[model samples]
Target: MSIGASITVVAVGAILSFATHVHSSGFSVIAMGGVLMVVGIVALCLQIAALHRQRQMTAAEVQPPERTVVVRPPSEY
Candidate 1:
């Protein structure tokens, strides 16, 4: 997920975990929200790592190539 989406997920998770009070027999909303928040954090970390790698690759590709020239002594005057 993109950064924005990840942030949204975390926000929604936070709201669910803290803003509401719902009790169900099957599962806990707070726990679900915590899981979602963790997922969002993981996504965000992965995205950042991917972008960093891409930038490094781009920087490597953008560098100018080195050139070398050799001069030989003029043949017998």
Candidate 2:
């Protein structure tokens, strides 16, 4: 999903670039390109952050527990 979203952003950015090249006047085209580029970058960053977080969580689960024993006294001997 993230990959597809990123691809779509890039495609839109390309289209904006082409539009700006041909029209060369409307400010909207430049703004649209910038917005699309930012979206792609942010999406990529989020994906990387998510993977890193998952990896860290998994790694943490691997080590043994810090406090293992719970003591309780039995009834009268």
Query: How many residue pairs clash in each candidate at the backbone level?
Result: 0, 0
User: Per-residue lDDT for 19-70 in model 2, tens only?
Assistant: 6664456567767887887888788788888889999999999988888787
Query: Per-residue lDDT of 23-44 in model 1, one digit per residue for the tens?
Result: 9999999999999899999999
- Model 2 lDDT on a 0 to 1 scale: 0.79
Cα-based lDDT for every prediction:
0.94, 0.79
Give residue 53's lDDT in candidate 1 (0 to 100): 100
Best by TM-score: 1
- Candidate 1 deviant stretches above 4 angstroms: 68-77
TM-score of 2: 0.57
TM-score of each: 0.84, 0.57
Candidate 2, position 71, lDDT = 84
Model 2 pairs whose backbones collide: none
